[model samples]
Target: MTTFTDLNLCPELITTLKDLGYKQPTPVQAQAIPLVLAGHDLIAEAQTGTGKTASFALPMIDRLSRTPVEGEYHEIRGLILTPTRELAAQVGEHTLEYGRLLGMRVISIFGGVRFDNQIRKMKRGADILVATPGRLLDMLVQKKLSLAHLEMLVFDEADRMLDLGFIGEIRQLLAYMPEQRQTLLFSATLNDSVEVLADKLLREPKRVAIAARNSASQQVKQSVYAVDNGDKADVLSFLIHGGNWRQTLVFTRTKKRADQLTAELLEEGISAVAIHGDRTQRERTAALAAFTAGEVRVLVATDVAARGLDIDALPQVVNYDLPNQPEAYVHRIGRTGRAGQQGRAISLVAPDERRFLQDISALIGKPLQLQPVPILENGKLIEGGKLPEKKRNQSGKTRKGGANTKAASKAAKRAPLQPEEPVAPDTPGKRPSLFGR
Candidate 1:
């Protein structure tokens, strides 16, 4: 029954929460806010939609509000590092929204945009800076900013940063900050590498674990359709249009697949857009906004582009292609079923991708409900459509009569891309998207 008001937050924050209709603190927020306010270097294992941004933002804002730094010149006091630009922008936007009345200045810095604008903002100095590692490092090297006055450092989504190869930059950034400052590390999972990073950065950190490590949100209803790889797009289009889905987020494996999927969806009369590393900042922002506003019904994204994307009330998430890494799958469906909301995640699994599905099931410790693909064929719903077998060409004829040929084909179907971690052997366990609108 603990509420935001009972958490000893500042009156401005309480009022703002009321205005924003956030009646009570989420589990992570309720537990983490007090620890942060107490000035503890903490490690919190929580996902994106658990109101985690507010958990740390509220306390940081409260402390900064109590003691406003005043001078013609401004020094950076708070720093938050995120893996993707989308997430950095989200954290920066939330900080400003919560701390706006307190006269706190916040800025988000990342690559893909012109540097002069960020440099101009840096000249003014931000009270709270949310940035990607590379751009922040660039600013540091150019002597455009200093962390000498930094009092708080937050590494939001630390595991994702490690996955994206920011460990060295993170270390370099940590070296510049004062060791005495409070550090808060938040991530969906605290794997061994994240633990090592926290050990080096935090000082006897108070640990707050909201869930078991590397598990998907319990609220998501996960299921998969066993279909042929060639039929994935047809199945995805059928589900969106046939099921009458609104505001679906689809995840694809590659940027090229994302772009192609978007085009395919559009051709099918679905309003879809693709967001990836190749998209300019403005395009990415516009695509996200359109999807959020329901102007676009579907948003197709790659694993990298989807990081730190906070879409509210997203009811469905589709995986057009299974991710190579099990952890990546966890983060993809995480886009929906957030903040205790009921959500559905569906994956299109080809015969070749069953092993990938097995890898995911092992990681999550549960088997996903498997159903045969239902297809619209010849003006009727067809269940378990048999895909056409390939004919023998030059390569197939070479091995056609070999005794081991059948076994070799089976082995090839079973072979999956190596996961970052060992694929758990197929055991009894819980079993276990898209480009554009």
Candidate 2:
């Protein structure tokens, strides 16, 4: 049987991995590390929690540990571009943790934080730079950081990065990088766009794709619950507090809904907070830390900001609102059942979400059996109660953008905004967050 020992990683990386309690390499990591170590460009289609960070990080560290350091500037040897700031921080941590034994200096750059601090850090140079496209581009434009020395360029979560509209920024960063450098792109699914990006960036790259569609990790058992809009919160509260679920990540469709739900959950005496693009970077970081440290029991978030985020031991994930895009369903549920641990995913589907549910089922290539929403005898949610399928708002009339007639204006004043993708079907693959979330 193959082991980390058999992978023949550098001793420095091996020591750090052992200290981090990694007994063996995951399939993606085992196959990927060797290829990366050989300075080969790669496109690894692996799920979020497959330890891909270490897969690429170990190789970067092995190659950079003995690099010819010049004066004080560490000369960035590797650049890892991630979509969200949270993911940027995560990949940065993994690089530092694994590369520390070899004296590799790791830096994480992302927007929302002040630029002066990042500029100051940039003056000293980073050995391994993990960044979100926005800040990296900002720094690049400011002439504070140069990619001249970058040896490895990685677009971690390539599809998510592109969906989030980081493609142009990625191209900008690429423009500055040495063309001869090795490139690596990793995502759960590889669509045509990712293939095109890889083709343009890599040099006859070795491909290692993992067919874990509708799956990030097998530990997450997925189920759906049909409910009315009014019962969604009641059902959620029951599952979290009633079911004794200490930690559950609930995904909402909008930032407003996230804030509203978090507030409601707190009123019910359940610890919860909302994380979204509207939040200051500090608030998002604090909320995530609180959740990680068990200070907060629930993290309610919007899909736009939470994709590609890695939360450890995530036992349960609840979709308070179904995502408009079917592909987002996989990303949301992928949060739970990670790294060989059992996890549960419960999605709440309203009458308006029927098509969304069906589309998700088709995307994953499996039918999702939806049960009824669990409610208390008084039409409330009871502890350990699993409700059978029930339709809410028999007519899912959301005041969508109908022609602006006088009667329409009157209806709009009274109707709530309809839930649907802001983008047209023609531009489906455009920016995932159009409003610059």
**Per-candidate TM vs. native?**
0.86, 0.87
- List per-candidate RMSD values in Å: 9.3, 7.6
Q: In candidate 1, which residue ranges exceed 4 Å CA deviation?
A: 375-437
Q: Write the per-residue lDDT of candidate 2 for residues 313-432, one digit (tens) a residue.
A: 898999888877777788888888778888988887777778888888888887886664433334333323233224233111121222222222232243343455523221225554
- Estimate the overall C-alpha local distance difference test score of candidate 2: 0.76
Measured by lDDT, the strongest candidate is 1
Any idea what lDDT model 1 has? 0.79
What stretches of model 2 exceed 4 Å from their correct place?
Answer: 214-216, 374-437
Show pairs that collide, candidate 2: 228-392, 371-389, 372-387, 372-388, 372-389, 373-387, 374-387, 375-380, 376-380, 376-381
